[model samples]
Target: MWTYQHSDFLVHQIPALENNYIYVVADKHSDNVLVIDPALAELVRDACKQLNITPSHILNTHHHWDHTDGNAQLVAWYGCEVVGNAADTKRIPHISKTIHAGESFDIGSLHIQSLDATGHTIGHIVYVIDDALFCGDTLFGAGCGRLFEGSFAQMWTTLQSLAALDEQTKIYCAHEYTLANLSFANSVDGNNPELQARIIKDTQTRNMKLPTIPSSIGLEKHTNPMLRALDDDFCSAYNPGKTPLEVFTDIRSKRNVW
Candidate 1:
């Protein structure tokens, strides 16, 4: 095994399933890597070999096929343990550890805490390790997950909890929806300069074809309109005469078509 250095967590932005992102987190210090929502099994394997590491764990954030589609293949190739939301047992393949909220585990030196995030799915989880957050489809840079299997209330509360993490936490959301989401944010919050700045930043990143992810929690709090559903000023500007829930529902509906 190769000796490890600093920042063992290797992030590979796999653009697949049409804009979805699947990250391969490897800790070289431990000679182990955890595949978070492996979009493709071969992709995960190649990523590990690229860094001379092996897959020890497969973490699924939700039961979505885009996220867990590589489960069986990864597990078979490396004999990794597949851990996922306790509610996704039957749907997602190879989920060996069905976890719940507050469940904590370790992969070598790093500690992983599972926070149940319900908006995306009943058992959708946000994995917290040190100052990093892997929030699958539940939370994005400028947007959030749809009410596919959960409710607005659940989504709102879950997002609030995630926001409470350290401001410096690197939020690795599982999609490349930032630019599109930021566009919707600007349309909804026309007067927000922070939103404008984000749009410009996103454009530059895309122009360079660079990864526009792993946004800071602090930045998301300032610019993400979806996460500001409770701000009275934001709500009023979003929909002049609508209630908070109405504003949220309206924004969500419009973004659905955007």
Candidate 2:
């Protein structure tokens, strides 16, 4: 588990069920603890138990089983409210409250904002709490999610919005896919100095069996091919003469096969 402390809340990144990470966020000012994208109940249950916390909510980024399979079990144990995208209420199990994109809400002292991220799956949404982004699979380190149920255009727009966030923002995506993503990124943008450094650094992190997640938006903007796909120079280097969206589409297509 990776723990991040803030003035008003505590975040615990719990690795479970292969690559998935379940985040347990405890608000310092209230009894409201939130579990985000829990892939299994035991890990989260154990973490909360150790922290002496009773979760007040289960927050899902999408209705995918890998992200929500433990929702029912957690809810049964804690009777916590489940929050997700309003359009996905029917899909997200045991959803109790619906939130829309651009909407802001408070969970105790933790201020939260929602962003529509529908490329990984339709109705997929990401949460922002302070500078930490629980993006599920919408965005990944060095890459982005596949267009599973959304169009390339939709996913492109979503990436644009997320890339525009504060550079200091920390990304808490759901999976451990950085190494493979870096491999693909190197194939397309191998000469990038920042990416080369990141590959070496993240390689060491993984070699030590530590998580390489919680990558900063600033680092990603400088290294991730998907985010860099927005740059004209990147487009010229890879898919010459293509527009930003065109470059993004080309990268996604190549990544799909890679």
Candidate 3:
């Protein structure tokens, strides 16, 4: 388990189901607890026990089984209100509140805004809480999710929106794919010194059996090749003559078989 101690909340990242991370956030001011992507009930239950919290809400980023498998059990245990994309209500188990992109909601004193992230799946939405982003399977540390049920354009648009966020924003994505993603990033953007440094740092972190998540948007924008698909200089250097969308498509296609 890894914990990010915030001034207003304590964000607990519980490792489960191989690389999946189940997040339990405890609001310090209002004492409100929330769980994001509770992949397994037992893991979430134990984390909540350690924190002495009964989560009042559950936030689901999408309808994938890995993200929603524990929703029913947690809702039964805590009688929590489950929140997810409005279009995913039918698929997200026990979902009680549906929100659309750009919608803001309050979980006690915590303010959360949803952003459309429909690449991995239709109706996928990521939550923005303060400076922390719980982006489940949409944006990885150095890569983006595969276009399972969305177009390259949709996924590129989503990535562009996230890249435009505050540089200091902390990305609390759901999986531990930093090392692998960095390998792919280096394959395409090998000349980037920042990407080289990230590969080394994340490799060391993994060697220590630590979570290499909660990557800053600044770090990702500088090191993630996928995010650079639209950069004019980047395109001119690596994929000259390709339009922004074409560049994005080429990157995603190459990553599919990487």
Residue clash pairs of candidate 3: none
In model 2, where do residues sit more than 4 Å from their true spots?
none
* Residues forming the 10-long window of minimal summed lDDT in candidate 1: 1-10
Count of residue pairs whose backbone atoms collide, per candidate: 0, 0, 0
User: Considering lDDT, which of the candidate structures 1 and 2 is the better prediction for this target?
Assistant: 2
lDDT of 1 by residue, 57-156 (tens): 8898888888888988888888999998777788879888888787999888778899989987888888997777899998897999988989877877
Window of ten residues with lowest summed lDDT in model 2: 230-239
- Between candidates 1 and 2, which one is better according to TM-score? 2
Residue 93, candidate 2: alpha-carbon lDDT: 92
A best-first ranking of the candidates according to their lDDT comes to: 2, 3, 1
Error of 2 at 46 (Å): 0.8
Candidate 1 lDDT at 129 equals 79
For residues 1-258, write the lDDT of model 2, one tens digit per residue.
889987788889999888888999999899999999989998989888888889899999999999999899989998989999899989999999999977889888889999999898899999999988999999999989998899988999999999999999999999999999999999989999999999999999999999998898999989998988777788887777788888888889999999
Quote the lDDT for 9 in model 1. Answer: 62
